[model samples]
Target: MSKKKSFPLRLDPELYEILQKWAADDFRSVNSHIEFLLREAAKKAGRLKKSQE
Candidate 1:
């Protein structure tokens, strides 16, 4: 694993609830779900280049 950093995150109430439910359904932590979403979105948006910081 690379060096890890922690940052405060803010989420919309409704959106966060949905993400929480989906994450539970998939048996993944909310953090993992968010990471998956970011990876996929980056791929689709053509921003997967330049090392996935």
Candidate 2:
């Protein structure tokens, strides 16, 4: 497994609420859902490196 980096994130209250609802709908924690979205976006842009899994 790769080491994961952590950082502080600030979101507008309304946006956070939306993300919470979406995450719940997808059966994912907000953090996982955000990472999923980011990974998908990176893949779509051809910017994701091949994983070592």
Candidate 3:
């Protein structure tokens, strides 16, 4: 397993529900799904590179 960093996040109720549903559909925990979404978003924005981490 990778080293984990804990942080606090805030989300709107509506967006939170949508993410929750998507997580359930994918059979993943909500936190994992959010992490995946963040990774993808970062890839598109070029904030994350192949070896940055």
Candidate 4:
């Protein structure tokens, strides 16, 4: 496994609540769900290399 970077992020309360529910529905933590969404987006946009996937 790779060492993960840590940083603080700010989100609107309403958005956070929505993400919280979505995360629960997916059986994931909010943090991991966000990362999964971003990774999928990057892959779709061809911004991520194959190795990165």
Candidate 5:
């Protein structure tokens, strides 16, 4: 596995709670869900290359 970058992220309490529930529904941690969402969005926007995806 490649080394993943780590950074601090801040979100509003309401947003965080929503993400927590969504993550649980998908059987994923909140962090992983966020990454998944971002990756899919990048792909849809043509911002992510095939290899990257």
Candidate 6:
């Protein structure tokens, strides 16, 4: 596996609560859930390269 990059994220309290719930429902850690969502979005936008896989 490639090294994962890290960065600080800021979220509104309400949004954080929503994400926490969603993550739990999906059986994913909050950070992993966020990454999954972002990856899906980038794939949809054609911003994620196959080479990066």
RMSD for each of the candidates: 2.4, 1.7, 1.8, 0.5, 0.5, 1.2
Q: What TM-score would candidate 6 get against the native?
A: 0.89
Once fitted onto the true fold, the runs of candidate 6 whose alpha carbons sit more than 4 angstroms away are none
| Candidate 6 lDDT, 1-53, residue by residue in tens | 88999999999999999999999999999999999999999988999999854
Alpha carbon lDDT of each predicted model:
0.89, 0.89, 0.92, 0.98, 0.97, 0.94
Clashing pairs in 2: none
Best by lDDT: 4
Instruction: Give the higher-lDDT candidate: 3 or 4.
Output: 4
The sequence of per-residue lDDT tens digits that candidate 4 reaches over residues 1-53 is 99999999999999999999999999999999999999999999999999999
Best-to-worst lDDT order? 4, 5, 6, 3, 2, 1
Query: Could you give candidate 5's per-residue lDDT for residues 1-53 as a string of tens digits?
Result: 88999999999999999999999999999999999999999999999988897
Cα RMSD (Å) between model 3 and the true structure?
1.8
Cα-lDDT of candidate 3: 0.92
Worst 10 residues of 1 by lDDT: 44-53
lDDT for 36 in candidate 4 is: 96
Model 4's lDDT to the true fold?
0.98
TM-score of 3: 0.79
| Reference-based TM-score of each model | 0.76, 0.86, 0.79, 0.96, 0.96, 0.89
Candidate that beats the other on TM-score, 2 or 3, i.e. the better one: 2
- Candidate 3: tens digits of C-alpha lDDT, residues 1-53: 87989999999999999999999999999899999988999988989978853
